[model samples]
Target: MTFAVNPNASLFLLPDPVTCFRSASYNQIQTFHLTADASAVILDWVTSGRRSLGEEWVFSRYYSVNEVFVDGKRIAKDAMLLDDSQIDAKPLPERALAERLRPYSCYATLFLVGPQVQAVIAELVRRYQAISVMKMKSPDKVIWSLSPITGNDYTSVIVRVAGEETEDVKGWLGEGLEPLRQCIGKDVYRQAFR
Candidate 1:
C-alpha cells in the first residue's frame, strides 16, 4: 500500500491520507497496472487519473531522448529524481513513467478504491474486456472489506496506503503487504479475476 509512486517520496506534496477518495467518474488518479516478469515490472497506465489526457509509457530503455537538452549531455535517462528529497515528488503529469534496466519483471497489482473502485473495475472487465474478471473479498481483520483491484493485465495491485501502513510495507514486502497477501494471494487474485 505504501509504495513510492511519488517521485519525491514525501507526504508533503502527495499526502498519504487515511482514507481513499474518488471523483464522480470513479477515477481520481492514474494507476499503473503492472505485471512482474521474473525480475521486472511491465506496465501500461491502468487508469489515467486524467481520463482525457491519455496514457504513454516514457520508455527510455526502449527509446532514446537526446533532444530534451540536458546541458548538452545525451540524456541516457530522464527522471526528476535529482535529489533524495524529491523521491516522492509527483513528476509533472506530462512526464509519464520512464522505463529502466531490469533483469526480471517483478510481480505487482493495481486497482482503484474509495467509492468508485468497484464500479470502475466492473466496467473495465465487462465493457472493455481489459479486465477479464474480479471479485471482492475481505483481506484485513479489522477492516470491513478488501476489494482487491484484480485483472489479467496486472501483476501488482497498487492499493492506496493509509498512513503508517505505507511504512509497514514501504520496503515492497513486509507486514503491510504480508497481511494483504493473506487476503489475496497469487492464486486468489488470479482465480477471482479469471
Candidate 2:
C-alpha cells in the first residue's frame, strides 16, 4: 500500500511563516530541511514536496525525534524565546535552529525531515536505480553509507520510519540497501574538510 497523508495536515515550502498543527494544518512531509549557515547569513530550506515515500522514503517504517524549526523561530524549550538575545548576531541566528516540531501520530501524522544534503542524494539515486546498494540498519534507523574518496570515512544516508506508517515496519529490512553500494562505485568524492 502507498503511504498517505492525513486530511488535516497541509504542506508548505520554506517562508510559509505558519504554525504547524495550529488548525486543520498538520500533514506528512518528506525530506524537510531548514539549514542556516551562519557564515552565509542566508537560510536554505528544502522540502521534496513529498510527505512520505516518494524520494525520501527509502525504508518502510519512519520514526524520528529531532529538533525542527517551525515558524522561523529558534526554539529551545516549549517555544520559549529564552535565548533570542544571545543568538541574534550569528549569521543564521540560532532562532532559526531551535524551533521544535513533533508529529503526533495519534493524529495519524508522521512529519519527516531532511534533504539538508539533496544534490548528493539525487545524483546517487539517478546513477544507481537498478543496482543494489550497501546499508547498515540499526533498529528502525537505516543509514546510507558512503566512503570518502581520500580515505575511509563514510558519509551517511539516513533512512527512517515515520510513526504513522506503523504497518510497514517489517518491510524495511531489504529497504534501499543497494544505493549505498552503487553510490560508492569508485567515484566517491573526497570532500575538503571544513
Candidate 3:
C-alpha cells in the first residue's frame, strides 16, 4: 500500500524543535512502516510537497526517543544508536562514494534550528533539484541506507555541494538561508558539519 500521512498528528520535519507542540492535535500520529531505503522516498515526498497538510501524524515504528513525546507518551527508542555494535563496519565502495561525490564535490549533514523548517526544507528540495544533475531529490536519496534523524525541537538535513571546500559550501548554504530565516525568524541556528 502507498504511504499516507496520518490525519491524527501534526506534520513537521524530524529533529523536533526544542519547544512544545504548536497545537493540541499535533499528537497521536500514524505513518507507514518504512524501511531505511523507503524512508528516503518518504522524506522526498514530504520535501517535494506530495503530503502537504496535516499537523498530527503517526509512524509505523518510533525510530528514536531523543526528545519526541506526545501527551506524555514517548515514541519508540532506537537501541542501535545506543549500541556501537549495531552499526555495520564495512566501508562504502569507492565507486559508490565516487558516484555520490560526483557532480557534488562535497557533502554535509546539516543541523537546522528555527521555525517553519518544513517550509525551509521545501525550498531546499527545489534548490537541490535545480542545481544537482542527479535524479534523486537530496543527498539522503543517494545514500538511502542512512536512517532519518527524528528529534523534537531540532531537525537534520543532508546537503551536497558542487565545491569541496568547507568555506564555499558554507557560503552556498548561507546565501539561501536568509529567505528561510524570514519565515522561521532570525533566531535560526544552522550548523553544516560533515
Per-candidate Cα lDDT values, in order, are 0.24, 0.25, 0.31
TM-score of each: 0.17, 0.18, 0.30
Which one is best on TM-score? 3
* Greater-TM-score candidate between 1 and 3: 3
**RMSD in angstroms between candidate 2 and the native structure over all alpha carbons:** 20.3
Per-structure clash totals for the candidates: 29, 19, 21
Query: Could you give candidate 2's per-residue lDDT for residues 1-194 as a string of tens digits?
Result: 11222233322221211122211222233332233321000111212113443432211222222233323432211111211123455465453212321221111111122223334444444544554655645322222222222123222232322332322322221132223223223232111000
Native-to-model Cα distance after best TM-score fit, residue 128 in candidate 3, in Å: 2.0
Candidate 3 ranges beyond 4 A from true positions: 1-107, 112-115, 132-163, 183-194
Candidate 2, TM-score vs. the true structure?
0.18
List the RMSD of every prediction in angstroms.
19.0, 20.3, 16.2
Candidate number of the best lDDT? 3
